[model samples]
Target: MIDKKQWQAEQAQFNDTSRYNDIMDKPRHVSHAHLPMTGRDRAGQFAPFAALTGYHELLNKIAQRYVNKKYPTGAEEQAIFDFFHQLPTGDAVRLELTYFNGESGYYEHYRGTLDHVNWAQQVAYFADGPQIPLRNIRVVNRKGNAHGQG
Candidate 1:
């Protein structure tokens, strides 16, 4: 059974209006940038869920796919996995997320940097699927979109 407290914490972090309008679009909740890292020690620490879950393996897949690219650390990977492992999985997904400005926090501004910015300004994060909790880094239609600029 899913741990009540652990699931609650994950749910709290992932609590956002999640609606996928299309399979070809990003999650209205989580972007595709911050992919979770599967813990190397699947036999311990997170063994409770890892015992009967595929998310651990999925984390490894996500790491192998974009581990070196995002400059992620061991803890960051674990955090990502602990967050998204709640969602259903099938096909592997390539995720991305918010852009940063210096080191204030997360990129939450929608100022339209280039006016006609043609590229998909949405932050991308790779995951096992699109049902993951996607907050902190959001866009206009995105859930975690912040306001104002520094």
Candidate 2:
């Protein structure tokens, strides 16, 4: 490698602008062939974008890998109904609700406090804001209860 003095001398020579005296103060050339791009248009070229167009579809497919809606058996359904009826309306009850999601064809587990049940709509309202259909429920577990019915 060159010594420090030799590198400094080379850098000094490179920094000299006397050689470009003719064009040092000249204006920047403007292109006549193409119109100027707006700031928004110029930024669009380097802006963030989704390279994989169908990436969301791929994720959905992966999520549905094990999807096959499971229905409760006759005895299990009876147990689920019996458990649901026992819960007092407008009472705070921590529960683990296992219900089938028709769109994804998979069982979904929601753990939260039961707010109330809308009997006319056949939906169970939870404090955390999920209104699940009674028919879709496959399993229900009341928190602190060792035995859960499915």
Candidate 3:
């Protein structure tokens, strides 16, 4: 603990504007003719530099979750193929589809009514709007029916 009078004296000295003004009023002597930098240019000098380019991107890629493409068994493949053939034409069929998302590089499951099935293109179009490739599909379930059923 400091004495109250001494503390007040110290505070008075620190708060003295004349002392601060005296230091700030001193002329700055520069050896060479150099133009003063703008605030933006001055900030650029202290801006953070990336030592290793793409390091953050590489780390983000490593941290991102990815689902490996699943290869169905012979029986499972046949079942999926059969379901595509049996689909009622022009009828909205509710389906649970698990397919690879190319953009995310991950497998995503979606439950929605299928708008169309393009046998030629081997893609299933969802009512909510998403065309999933049949080759990337891992699982399928018809609405009101159990898994593996059309």
Candidate 4:
């Protein structure tokens, strides 16, 4: 069973008044290498591991809403990726991610931390896999505009 109340709370927090929307929905882009450069000048630039907050909660939500109903496969990833891809490069949603990445089931509740937000640059493309790993999560600085400052 899922923590219905807690999930609702977290969703509320994620959608709270935050510029997360601006960041998640950007139209510009930049690409980083997914491979490594162990011994060269590019030595620490190509790490592939990604860190996503609320890892489990996010996964579970997506699974239930998008994956659990059917076979979780490469195509599933493509679907998720495509969904994100179509999101006008300028409308990212900042959802609250849980701490411990969902290590404790009860920890699934939102802790009210803005630790990070994904700009949703571009959804990762996985040709074949069990599930699509949330990849290319660019940290958004949310540059301010003319009228008001960030």
lDDT of 3: 0.75
Task: Please write out the lDDT profile of model 4 over residues 26-118, one tens digit for every residue.
Answer: 775644755444485454454433354467787777555432122335654454444444434434333322111112222121212122224
lDDT digits (tens) for residues 1-150 of candidate 1: 357998998887787535533553654466479764457754467668746677767666655544323334555544443434433355442233433332333343322222111124322233332221222323222134222121
Predict model 2's lDDT versus the native: 0.76
Q: Positional deviation of 119 in candidate 2, in angstroms? A: 2.0
Candidate with the larger lDDT of 1 and 2: 2
Candidate RMSDs in Å, in order, are 26.2, 16.9, 15.6, 28.4
lDDT of 3 by residue, 11-111 (tens): 99887787577679778876578877789988787666645667777766655534455567777777777877888888778888777786677788889
Error of 3 at 58 (Å): 13
Q: lDDT values of the candidates?
A: 0.39, 0.76, 0.75, 0.37
lDDT value, candidate 1, whole model: 0.39
Candidate 2 residue lDDT tens string, 1-150? 357999999999998888899998999888999999899898788655645667777777776753675655677766766777888766688988778876667788889988888778888888889888877887777765522345
| Residue 16's lDDT in candidate 4 | 87
Clash count, candidate 4: 7
Give the best candidate by TM-score. 3
lDDT of 3 at 96: 82
Ranking 3 against 4 by TM-score, winner: 3
> In candidate 3, residue 29 scores what lDDT?
77
What 10-residue stretch in candidate 1 is worst by lDDT? Answer: 110-119
Off by over 4 Å in 1: 1-68, 88-142, 145-150
